[model samples]
Target: MNQTSAARPLVSFDGVSKHYGSVVAVHTMNLEIYEGEFLALMGPSGCGKTTSLRMLAGLEEPSEGEIRLDGQRINEISSIERDTPMVWQSLALFPFLSVQKNVEFGLKMRAIAVEERRQRARKWLERMEILELAERDISQLSGGQRQRVALARSLVTEPRILLLDEPLTALDANLVVRMQGVLARLQKELGITFVYVTHSQSEAFAMSDRVVIMSQGRIEQIGSPKAIYRSPASRFVADFVGANNILSGSITETGEDLKISTAVGEFHCEKNSDRDFNTGDTLDLVISADLVQISMEGPEVQNSLRCRFISEEFVGSIVTIFAELEDGSDFKVQARQRDLANMALEEGAAFFASWNAADAHLIGGNGA
Candidate 1:
């Protein structure tokens, strides 16, 4: 657990479920949201990430269990009084209103004085670095400018927590990166909790202090970006995270270094003390693509497989080589583009892919 998990949670969903008729949107979820931490709920569409965010925002009421805010039961509380403001994907800016007016809309609803609302709006606009655009009409501003307006509007009341549901989806690729930095810096500076929902893996892993992976209305895994990427807790997590090769195998021996027999060949991995494995137990091992090395000759590694080159994908300086293992299972190796060029690997060429036994992580077992 990190420092955030050690502290008392600012918001919590205890055995929470949201259902409509016979269909379940969220099912029996227990999660804690720490104060001043950026927590991202990520998954595929219809995975209930948005619904979870809505429940926290008081936009949707849970059919079962409780939603709490600052140790107070808030399931029955109204959205306006919850102190949880939401920034929508559409930005939802008023086209008829100027930039400053759009930001002051939230304050005005709270019955704050007109002068005070104007001052607060101006202050936030300056903080967002859009003070010069305060007087411009909403239609005259760019997408990024309007996003700032939406953020200022949601934050004008100075709420304790902010809810964002794919607020950066409308921006272009470059703008999304810029806004990620903006949001990360703003959350750190304000020291307030941010519960963000998105389907993009890059967006979630790039900015979140911790990530919640949900599938079919159930929580799959919750951990820091590095933890989820390097050591997935389950096969579902390993597959959903991508760039990982999960090999099905059965334990042939058990000790400090367990030997597992798979279709490709025999492999060994350091035993996880948390799990107990007996001989003949079925399990899965996760190997990150970046950890696998490809060589023209078999390397001196604990785990090595002869694979046939299938194809390669290039993303700037990084390259991903796809190959088929002896068992016909797909494997991948990620390395520098220049380094791979030296090998001059060709389609259908045979090569050895190897990795240290310590790099393999185990999942699934009788005591997993």
Candidate 2:
């Protein structure tokens, strides 16, 4: 999420699609990754995020359309000729080679002079705080240290764009946080274009200037984390991007305030997108857990549902309340811990769950 205002795209996928026999891996993606920006491509397994990255890296060619870097098509380019270097999840360091040698491997392949390669490798190692481990064997290092080594190796080539394929997937929780900061800082200081691929929405939200959400080998939506979370373009985007509670129904009324009739009840809703939805059209209502409020006495808001409190989970500063509607549908509410204390909730106790109409997002489409 670096400074990308008025930025030109460093990479472009123009009607790009990939096929393996009868299987369609990626289906005609049209996207642009701006220079000096952290762009994340996120989705489930086999959704073509890694396939897109591989195509950009020249590891795999697109079956249709063109992939361009700086407006120049590179479909026929070799991996070595492309300026995009990737940090793989496995790291892929040479087991027998020293840290310094591993970091300098790319330079060696390009036939850089040995002395200059050592100097550059040492410089990057120093930046990664692993200069002391330059002479150490790959097997002698810890997981975090190896991750840094992989980062240094990818960055030592001074690529114009850095492609990351879930490089932090192997780290522990704390290490993952630390590496996230490391990656963010490096991207900021260097101001290089980054195309990251991951399945974690939190990671994408925390690091990227914009997130590209994919589903079933096609792009669902592309927007900032805030935009995507607050106003998802489709039911799939809403479900995949966050813990949003969705209700299926048909439009009973439409105007400044839309209304949907569902099994739970009729809910007043607000449009999340600019698309026009008519009366009787199928609709999916998305409500964030935090937006759902609870009252033991009675309904305090417009859209209200009466349900029994099933359980409560306290996680750090937030508390999650799980409940079941009269129709037996699961419902959840997230609130501050202090707020939960005010409710004095008990299991199996009937309560009113409510939310403001402004907080409910109406999506006129089918769900995931």
RMSD for each model, in Å, please? 1.5, 2.1
Give the number of the best model, judged by TM-score. 1
**Count of clashes in candidate 2:** 0
**Across residues 231-341, which tens digit of lDDT does each residue of candidate 2 receive?**
888988988877688888998888888888999999888765667778888878889988888888776567999989999888899988889998999888888998777
In model 1, state the lDDT of residue 300.
Answer: 75
Q: List the lowest-lDDT window of 10 residues for candidate 1.
A: 1-10
lDDT of 1 by residue, 2-108 (tens): 25435888898999999989999999999998888899999899999999999998899999999989899999998878879999999888899999999999888
- TM-score of decoy 1: 0.97
At residue 135, give the lDDT of candidate 2. 97
State every prediction's TM-score relative to the real structure.
Answer: 0.97, 0.94
Scored by lDDT, the top model is 1
Query: Residue 285 in model 1: shift from native, Å?
Result: 0.7
